[model samples]
Structures are given as C-alpha cells and as structure tokens.
Target: MPAPRIKICGVTQAATLHACIAARADYVGFNFCPPSPRFLSLPAARDLGAQANGRITRVGLFVDADPATIAEAVEAAGLDAIQLHGSEAPQTVAALKARHGLPVWKVISVSGAADLAPAARYAQAADLVLLDAKTPKGALAGGLGLKFDWTLLAAWRPSGPWGLAGGLNPANVAEAVRVTGAPLVDTASGVETAPGVKDMDLIAAFCQAARS
Candidate 1:
C-alpha cells in the first residue's frame, strides 16, 4: 500500500505553513470557522494561502458558512479546495460545489458504523469525504483531538475518494494506516503544542511516521 498523503490542518502562522511545506505535507488547511481557535481571517488566509500556493494544496475549512462567505474566502485566498465541517446536507454540498467550481471535502464525524451512513449521499456531491471523530454537542467543528475506533474502517467503502482524521499523531499514525488503508491522513490537534499552536518538531515527526 502507498503511504498516505498528509494534511496538517488549522495552520495559522506563516512559519507553520512553511514548516508544513518543508515537511512535504500534501495539504495545508486554514480554518475559517469563527468558533475555532485556529480561525483565520480572510486576509490572513490570503497571505498564508499564497505562501503555500505552488508547493502545497491550500484548503480552507468552513462550517456551514454561506455561499457568499465561501466565495469571498476562495477569491481572497485562492484556495484549491474547501472542507465543510458542518451539518450541511447533501444538496447544500452539491450547490456549493456547483457555485464555487472547487472541490468540496465533506467531513463525516464518526462515532460508529452508523455514522458513516451518510457517506454515499455526501460522495455524490463532495469531491472527497474526510472521516473524522464525532465531537461533543455544540462544540467547535474540528481539532477536538478525539478518535473513533479505527477498526470501524476495516471495510469502509465511500463511493469516491476518502481520508481519515482525528487524534492522529506520529507514534500511532503508521498503525492507523495499517488498519484503515486511508489514502489521505489529516491531523490538527495532534501536532499542536497548545490549542491552535502547532509544533514544528511534531509536524516533521508526523509526516515521517505517516510515510513509514
């Protein structure tokens, strides 16, 4: 099996963005959800996204945001894609993809096998489906550092492209790959020194571990 492509989400600093690039992470995510500690301003996202443009795929993370809001952020940041970490329905995901003409990665918050029931619906509209751990009631969308049972993915079969997220760090990532066969692996809180603070060493270690 191929080593999974890596995404370091919730990147807020230029240095962190550069570190993600230097570490050869495939995707660099910027948060636009207002409630998130990792939230990035459109202007800031613009700058950081530009800094990462050619070397990495810049993904803007949103949570049930309006079309105008997503459009404005895409224009400002020149985002290659947008990740929806909200309660958006299937039609809504399709509408956004049609309006923006950009790939939409819908986050599936999984606590069990039943939670994955929405995958087929979402796959029809979303360009990719990212399976992450379910969060608490009324909590912020992502970077919660919670993990679901990896065995639940033993036969996960999304209609289209898929990836894994939540509670993944260097030490456990190789094993995560071994069990899940996820072609893409995403991490946020796992490499953080604090809420919204990413550690350079952890970022490097995570990329290396995922590839091993």
Candidate 2:
C-alpha cells in the first residue's frame, strides 16, 4: 500500500502553510472555529488558502457551524473539503455536501468502541470519517492533544473512507499507522510549539514519519 496521506492541521500563518507544503503533506487545515487558539477569520483564512492554492488540499475545520456560515467560509476560502468537528447529524452532513458541492469529513470522537458507531452512521453522507479523541464533557472539541487507545482499531473496521487523528506526533505516528493501517492521518497540536504555534521542523519530521 502507498504511504498514508498526511494532513497538517490548524495552520495559522503563511510560513506554517509553506512548512506543510515543503513536507509534502497532502492536506492543510485552516480552523474556522472562533474559540480555538488556531481559529482564523474568514479574510485571514481566505488569504492563507489563496497562498496555498494548488500546492495542497485545503480543509476548513468547523465546529457546529450553521449552513450560512459554512457556505460563507467555503466560498471565501475556496476550501477543498469541510471537516465537521461537532455533533452534527448525518442529515446535516448530507445537506452540507449537497449545498456546497464539496466533500465533508465527519469527526468521530472515541473514548470507547461504542463511539465508533457514528462512523457507520456517517459513512454514506461523509466523504471521510476522522477518528478523534473525545474531549471531557463541556470542554472544547479537538486539538486537545489527547490520544485514545489505538488498540481499539485492532478489531474495528470502518465502513468507508477514514483518517486518524488525536495526539499523533513524529515519534508515534509510525506506530499509530502500524496499528491502525489508516489511509489518511491528521495532526495539529502534535506539531505545534504551543497551542496554535506551528513548528516547521516538527511539521517536517511528522510528515516524514507518517510517510515512512
């Protein structure tokens, strides 16, 4: 099998965008969730997306965003796909896909095997199901840098396309892939110096490791 696709997420600067590109990452994510440290305004996201056009697939990360807001960001940023990191229903995913004419990635937060149920629920509507760690109740979603049990995938089989995320870094991404056989892998905080701060060297190391 080919090496897994790598996505360096939550990019907030032109330099970080370039860093991901230089690492030959397949996808680069821009956060649109305002409360996130990595969140970017529509104009900022648009400019960054423009700068990376044609170099890598641009994914806009949203958390429980409304239709109008999603439409606005899609048009403004020219995103290649939308990653829903919220509790959106399968119907919501389908509606967004139909309305935007772009692929949708649904994030499935996993604390146990039961959490994997939604993957099947979203299989038909979502282009990709991103398996992420479940945050503490009442806490913010994703990029918390917490990892779930990778052993959960030992007997798990997804019904459709999927990506693995959560606390993946250069040191352990190889093991993550070995254990999960994921075709696509995403990381944000793992390569950051701090929340929302991308470190180019770590970005490069991570891509190399994921593709190793």
User: What TM value does model 2 have?
Assistant: 0.98
Candidate 1 per-residue lDDT, tens place, 1-212, comes to 99899999999999999899999999999899988889999889889878887999989999989889999899888999999999899898888888888899999999999999888888789999999999999898779899899999877776999999999999899999999998999999999989999999999999999999
lDDT of each: 0.92, 0.93
Once fitted onto the true fold, the runs of candidate 1 whose alpha carbons sit more than 4 angstroms away are none
Per-residue lDDT tens digits for candidate 2, residues 1-212, read 57999999999999999999999999999899989999989888889989989999999999999888988889888999999999899999999989989999999999998898879999999999999999999887999899999999888989999999999999999889998999999999999989999999999999999988
lDDT of 1: 0.92
Q: Candidate 2, overall lDDT? A: 0.93
Report the alpha-carbon TM-score of model 1 versus the true structure: 0.98
Q: Please give the lDDT score at residue 197 for candidate 1.
A: 95
Q: Per-residue lDDT for 109 in model 2?
A: 97
TM-score of each candidate structure, all chains considered together: 0.98, 0.98
